[model samples]
Target chain A: MVKKKLIYLDNAATSFPKPEQVYQKMDHCMRNIGANPGRSGHRMAIKADEMVYNTRETIKKLFNISNSENIIFTSNATIALNLGIKGVLQKGDEVISSSIEHNSVFRPLMQLIKKGVRVKFIPCSEDGFLDPDDVEKAVTDKTKLIIVNHASNVTGNITPIKEIGKIAKRSGAIFFIDAAQTAGNISIDVKRDYIDMLACSGHKSLLGPQGTGILYVRPGIELNTIIEGGTGSSSESENQPELLPDKLESGTLNTVGIVGLGAGVDFILKTGLDKIRNRKVFLTIKLLKGLENLNGIKIYGPGDAGKIVPIVSFNINSIDPSEVGYLLDERFGIMTRVGLHCSPLAHKTIGSFPKGTVRVSLGYFNTEGDIDYLINSLKNILKTKA
Target chain B: MDKELKEECILVFQTTHRTLQAENILKKEKIKIKIVLKPRSITTDCGLAIRFNAEDKDVIFKIIKNNNLSLMGVYSRSGEKWIKL
Candidate 1:
């Protein structure tokens, strides 16, 4: 039997069909230049070491970071958040977060509460828009960190990160941004945004492979190291080196994955971030408009395509989201995500708790035909009660 | 011994990243250089050092200073001890 074509709309979860160069470079690095970076003095090790640095430089260019050493690699955004959150907050410290945060941020803040740390979760509007004023109102003298989700996973609503970052600055608190959803999809400059720390997944919009994530910390803000091991520097001292990356990054790096990430970033740079984002937004407008015209369909978040990322969440009248998702896949070979999307607070805020909305996320690779197919599929499902 | 001493200077940096960064900057400038393991006698943060011709010392120092790289020190070997240049 021939394989069915896949129309993947789960870019919010992880991008699919990465650029050809990503795959090619990863294979090349694995086959030929596979060596432990920063561990050996051999030629292959040096090559591997240079590959890692070059990837870091590419990421630095993408995010407009000044110092490449400040960027640390982790397994995923979750680990990066853990490192930043647990490393900064201590007993009696206060934190300010949002209601639309993913489990990565929500769970860590919850864990910190058990240790006497306080957190204020500013609620967003029903449409999933977080107000900068609400964040400013929650600030206190004890506030040590102010972290916000750059965009909602369920609603795809983009928050006013720059305004909120200024609030953190005035309050003398560290501003951390969880850019898991918007890192590569939108523009985020650490200097312009006054961001003290930012963490994001490389696999999502960045189009890198799994097991790659990034955390950028500003120069002055100090965080306790959560994990420490050999950084291939200052080997004489048993203690971890007191430096930028070596202080945070430990153990062998994912050379194959990092090299692939470099190629992915190179593709973005050559193609232009604005061009890639515009393509996604154009398709999203079509999807949102089509869903609005369909009977018995209620879209979530901002109905405006310009206000959100390339994601659409909606529900059919009285139909279970899981069933709709299943039929869309079983009958049409369309892939999507249903349920809370690991954001229970967002579900509750949008009044989709227990039952969640079907999220259709677009990627740079998606086309107009994919959107039309999805809309037709949903219409067919609603009409036939599939 | 005089000829050998005039030919090479070991440039050490604070971290492997700085060492590699220095290597990149110097390589682009067309400097004749080699990455070598740090000598046991020199105590530095990174385990690698760049070995270049002693004649290029003035230009190398200028480049290092302009780039703002964390240069730990420069050293040359004497009969038994490593002397700081």
Candidate 2:
């Protein structure tokens, strides 16, 4: 029996083959500095505490955040979004979002609707492009929060976040962004963008291990605590401490995962985010170009690669998306995602709802050869259908 | 014993995050400081504090103030007793 090499194309879900440093640092943290940070006075515990703070400082630099303490770590982006949304909004508050939000933002906002909160989902174009004007038009004085997904996980459509951020600032609404798909793939400056809150998945574009995510809360945003417990501070007080991170972060953090995240961000900083993003863009362009001439194949989203992230969604005529995904995996050893991509609203906007499209999400580690092979494999699949 | 430890003061913080942050900022300035357990008598938010020479008190306070750290207070060790400064 022969083993086949697997080609991973599901980076939008979670990045694979993280930077070598990520693995090395995680190993070093577990083996050497395996103490709960900030909980003990031992040397290892102090070292662990320093490592966690260093990661915070590194992330602060990556996002152009003013204060390192504003960045809070969570299990994943979903948790971060939950904290930001539930923490800030009150009854009768109007929150606006886009049609192309991942369930992370959409579901949370929807749940708020039942709590007497008004939730308006601004519709996007067929190509999943969100017009900033629509967002501005939806803004009301009652609008307390404007949350938008930085990029679509399904179509890879990049929203006009800076313009929307400006509108939120003018309206005095908190501008929150779900950077689940854009964080490390695209550069973001929380200050310049006028973003009051930003949530991102460390496992996705940040190239960290799973169970790591970040939420950046601007200074002066008095968010209510969603969950509270022991924070290793003010031990005598029965109430949670009113510190920046300790106020929100209430438990033993994922120290090992965070250490790996630090190394991953360091890799991005040293290699340069633009360089990493450009490489994926180059490969994505090649993949899109290859799919253009294929018969009976319908490509979705911004057909132009430059207009979106390194993700492509398409479908073969007369075939179910899951079947296509299965064939690609079982037959060609390629891994791709199909079906709604956990974003039914985005699927509806792109007219691929119910039976979604096969999605190929490229990563920095993916090569041109990999794209060519995918194209050839897709071609083969199409030929058999005919 | 080092002359610096002969007369020492502990800088306390509201959270361990600030304590570690101040340690980094002070260490970069080549200021002598040691992270000692929060004095058993001092009930502060954090379990740790920076023990430095009483002579470095002014400089340490300046650094903490410049960084906008949430410092609880400074305490000096007078013999076996820790007195709040």
Candidate 3:
């Protein structure tokens, strides 16, 4: 008898069945170093501080940020994006971004537009890669920030950050990247590419716990803190004392989440981002190779295989993206995420913004066998209709 | 062919990057120093600890600190271990 179980392919959303070490390490930290970090002078507090430091250090190595203090924690990528976008942006300053950004970048920039900040969107092709020349043309004297998504969640295409970063530098605009999709799966070098701010999700790619991510701000650039509360370092002052890490970080820290994030980074670092990315690319190539022959199924993004990440977005003809998602989950016992993916512009650029597409994002733990099973399931579904 | 040859010196910083930044800054100052990883005896941070003759340690540390830069443990090698000043 064949055992029927679920196969989760929505890693672009959140990873499930985290490594045993992630849960175990977080459990041990909670039991032992359960004190408030950066709050007290006690050993537990110090241990908590040390734990966060070690984790942030590991992340610095992961992202290749020369200074570990530059990695500031946020509740998530959305909050980090909001903090990075809204804090530095001022009235009348123009910000240029792409048409494929997630709501995390779009919503904040849109809010800035409402507040008198000018917003411009550079168009991306239907396949999802942006035209860097369009970005070059968009820059003007008023432009202060250039925000872009590292990879499209809708199409799994990568942006030419190095090329666009040069454009921003030429225009004297601060370049901010929403690295939610690429954080753990790809290697990011902040200095080599001249990146100003990088908003990351600890949970998604880094395999860290949710409610914990980082916003990497280059030193010497100051932004107003969005939320203010106790920062343990400078309690004696009434005003929020501006300092590295603590200046941008406010309120009670997510100590346990941060600790788990550290362990997760350790895992990512050991596995190596290049190896992880290659594995996902191999799986995506395998699935795409199998899928191309199937009738009634349409695929998106570059076919070179290397151009795409582990993510794959597709739809079956005569079926709604949501219904395709539903059938895959209910009838197939395979968990998948469907719909606009919160990027209307991405959909608009790809001509599926309103209707959306079914997204399958692979992660480090997934195997070729998993891809084979998914391919079989999809073949079975579309075969009946064919 | 006669560029001013300022003596190369080692500079320590509070932040992990300062020691290297010091070397770069010193290059502009026409002074040079070989920056190396800070010894674990100073701090567990991945910060750099450089080596040069003893003459430049005080001035380098003073310049690095005066700039409000990060410095962990700064010292010169007395054979093997980094002896902190």
Candidate 4:
């Protein structure tokens, strides 16, 4: 009996198969040293703690962080965003953001808007690009932090982080980056980029297990804790351990995930992140060029080759994103994500909110053949959309 | 044998071990590379290295050479481990 193959184009959500090495590493950790990290003097516990520490150290190197201890572990990008938004933001402070932010970022900050903090969002162009000049004009004295996604999960548009960081620096507002979409895909140096606090999801581009994330807190910027609890160190004190990681990490922490994350960062350092990013850009440009020929397919984001990652968001004319998603799922067996993609404001900026765009996000393993198949599938789907 | 094996620590990597990477193999797999860590000698440049593995030396060097990449260093487990001639 022959079997129908599954074409996975939904890479922006979570990576697939996990490069074999990732799976093996996670399994080895779960099997060998499944001990509570930072708890005991035992060898297993020590090893586990070392694994988490080493992971933080690796992340420090990956993003060119000034200090290893400054990197903190969180549940995911959402949690990190909440922590950054909630911790540093006092009521009545102002924030400046781009329209192209995941709701994970927008919602938290938006929640504080009603509580006295003024929030201003810089609009993206129809093609999903944010302008630095527009950001410059939007800045006000009350603006405490300028939060924006490094790259859009929906449209793959990369904001001019450096230019905006400069604006924030001049205005005395801290720059917080949602590196959820760009962390492993693009090159980001906290020092060079002038980002004060950057949130990253380990599972997406870094190929780590779910529940693993990183928050790079630049030195001299202290974010108060949203959750306070035991940090293996400073047991005598009732206060959350005042140290960097302990202050950020409130509980037992995801040790196995962090161990895997260490390996993930090590992998990126070995492979050279620029090399990985170029391959995705190559495939994405190819996809864009093909979509240009097909009728009824509307592409979003700036058409510039180097402006984004492998993620693409588009839709067929008059076709609901749910219908498109179902057809790709049930008929074509090509797994693609559709709808608002948890970033309704971004969709609204691109004018695809209520019924959103079908997004195909590529990764390191995605090849030209995969792009071709996706293009062909969309073409076929378009022709049959009676 | 035990001491030598302990000295030669495996530098676990995410990508293929053959690929040129940031981590290094410490010289003298059994002993930590003390010279690299002289007091006040670290210039914010100290990085991780496994106790050196001799066999991995040539391949790693060749990768850097072929890729036109420069690395920090390479070595093998040493309590009298042979150096490349």
Worst 10 residues of 4 chain A by lDDT: A38-47
Worst 10 residues of 1 chain A by lDDT: A1-10
Better of 1 and 4 by DockQ: 1
Chain B: TM-scores of all predictions:
0.85, 0.87, 0.57, 0.35
Give the higher-TM-score candidate: 2 or 3. Answer: 2
Q: Each candidate: RMSD to true structure? A: 2.2, 1.4, 8.9, 9.9
Order of all candidates by TM-score, from best down to worst?
2, 1, 3, 4
The residue-by-residue lDDT of candidate 2 on A45-145, one tens digit each, is: 88999999999999998899988989999999999999999999988999999999998888888888999999999999999999999998999998999
lDDT of 4 by residue, A82-136 (tens): 9888988888898898899899988887788878888888889987888989989
Which residue segments of model 4 deviate by more than 4 Å? B1-85
Best by lDDT: 2
lDDT of 1 by residue, A342-365 (tens): 999999999999899999999999
Interface RMSD of each: 2.3, 1.8, 10.0, 12.7
Reference-based lDDT, residue A327, model 1: 85
Q: What are the candidates' individual DockQ scores?
A: 0.48, 0.71, 0.04, 0.03
* Alpha-carbon shift of residue A248 in model 2 (angstroms): 1.1
Alpha-carbon DockQ of candidate 1: 0.48
Q: Over the stretch A1-386, how does candidate 3's per-residue lDDT look in tens digits?
A: 35567888989887766777789889999999998766553557656666777787788898788777788999899999998888899898888998899998888888878889988988888899988899999898778999999999888898888889999989999999998988887778887777999998889988888888899999888988888876654455677757668777877789899988888888888887788888888888887887686778778776546887678888888688888788778777888889899988898888875888888888778878877877888877777656
DockQ of 2: 0.71
Name the better of 1 and 3 by TM-score: 1
TM-score of chain B as predicted in candidate 4: 0.35
Q: Model 3 TM-score?
A: 0.83
Clashes of 2: 1
